[model samples]
Target: MPQLDHGANALVGVMAAFGRFELQQELSGLTAVQAWNLLSPFLPLSQTDPMAFTELLCHGVTPAGGFAAYGASRALAELVGLSFDTPAAQAVLDGGIAFLREAGVPPMRVRPYEWDRWLDTGGNVESWLPVRPPPPPERPGITPLRPAETRLVAKLGAEQDSNRVFISRDGTDFVAIVDARYSDEDPTRARWVWHRASTLYLLYLQVGRSLQTPPHWVAAELEAYVPLPAPRF
Candidate 1:
């Protein structure tokens, strides 16, 4: 795995690799101290550094050239969840939850998805532009929201015109939905998909399982994930 010092873009690549490989075993010795060193190298002091950790989280995922702070925070939360049995790790989790509860406004919510929205010739509204791509698939077993209210959070890829990230958060928990685009004219080309392939998604899923409160529908699906059966000869 790339060191967090390398930057968030590198971390995002690492998250995607996890989905393609069953390498949870690789993380076997990944203790909270190690995870802290890997993710928040900004604080070289220790794992229990809530003041520094919270400040970084509040910085809105601006690790060099990254925009997904939620993803990074979720990744840390996953590590915290896996090792909550340890007193030190538990302290980190406690500090994080407390930070969330006490924060007047999280940086995650305050940052703009696009720093250059003024230059966006297309504008931002989903409907005002053109075709209404079918909504992303309802999570496997979760009841589909008839008209789920979602807001665009980030746009991924080089073109800055595709792979949209949308989210619906209800204060305590949030579900991120990906609306992947390929062609503008072909409605069939558009697909709504889970963000599972991304490290951010996987981290959130792992941490969600460990949260005391009910996990979001998307995160819950990770627990139920099963590989396809092999072809029988």
Candidate 2:
């Protein structure tokens, strides 16, 4: 197992990797209000005023464009394997409907049969279920997998590579990398880190891993270790 200091260093290195990949850019620009507007339509009608959601959806004032935005956002979420009928989405839709009704805008006119057919054609239904398998168990006491585990190899050429192994603070067992992203220099490494972190977080929650607090160091390492997705304008 690597020493705690080494683990900490590795964590720092991974966070640097995330910076290099521009992970922060993905989150930096949007204001809270914009985010609310984008997400509000998806909220449940029962818990919120449907009119508000509908208005948000319809207020942009373009028919095909509005529907396209909604469709694209929903499709992307589905592709990323999120649920379609989530309370959040429902609420947003309800608000949009109400807004349109009040404005006397014609109903967006997606026939149920036609909508289903469109969804089928777009292959959007595949990601309707949000459940995913847990990541492989961290090697015995190695603690959880860090973002570095996904990127170090690709950054340094395999021949120049150094392996990072660690023992869990519990002082039992150890985790050694089986594989990871190519290296710090590889652009894809950052994204790999993000995906790896997301997967690990999900797995941790699914398996009920206990932590005294948020693992900031681990998060930093992940952001550094993997490439991030591009920002959405």
Candidate 3:
């Protein structure tokens, strides 16, 4: 059994929290804090107790819940040099996403209007209306690819191309859902969509390791990276 480091332990707690919050949000469409009374029992002795943490996860987190949890876990691991690209890490992430999809949590999307309001109001925005401004057109040599985007493209074995990038009108952020072949004619090439929630998960892990509070802009940037489904409500 591998020992849990400070960073890993903190990451487990973050994942657990994210799992709980995502479940609550999905079931009620509301974001609420986990009640202290409800969460105290499963608290780990330290940040690196993967066993205790995994046990708690087994008891409370489902597959859909795992999506948020595992995503956060992987991000934390990556930041702390914990080998996120390992087979174990991949299993955790794949299992979590599968679980969420099976549980009927809709595919995630980016909603910029809500994000803007969240930033303006210090995360007190209440509306879910689709209201974000269109992302600035992808400039020829100006836009920078986020770390996550770069990592994901590399994972997909695709070369980076500026023309391949597109921005969501709702969230006004860059997206890397481009052809794996980097060709205009082959529409069937692989494309991966990166979301704000996923990026937020990464940021949360970063913050947890530093034990530092992130400014609202960090959250706002993450929110811009969130991917959303078509409007249904």
Candidate 3 regions exceeding 4 Å error are 1-20, 23-31, 35-38, 46-48, 55-89, 103-233
**Tens digits of per-residue lDDT for model 2, 31-125:** 54543443343445313543433333333221323233343333223222233354444433333333222332221232243244335445232
List runs of model 1 lying over 4 Å from the truth. 1-46, 60-67, 79-233
What root-mean-square deviation over C-alphas does model 1 reach? 19.9
lDDT tens digits by residue: candidate 1, 42-113: 434225554444344334232322223323344445433333344433343333333232332222222232
TM-score of each: 0.21, 0.21, 0.26
Name the lDDT of candidate 2: 0.31
The collision pairs in model 1 are: 15-199
Q: Lowest-scoring 10 consecutive residues by lDDT in candidate 3?
A: 208-217
State the weakest 10-residue window (summed lDDT) of model 2: 189-198
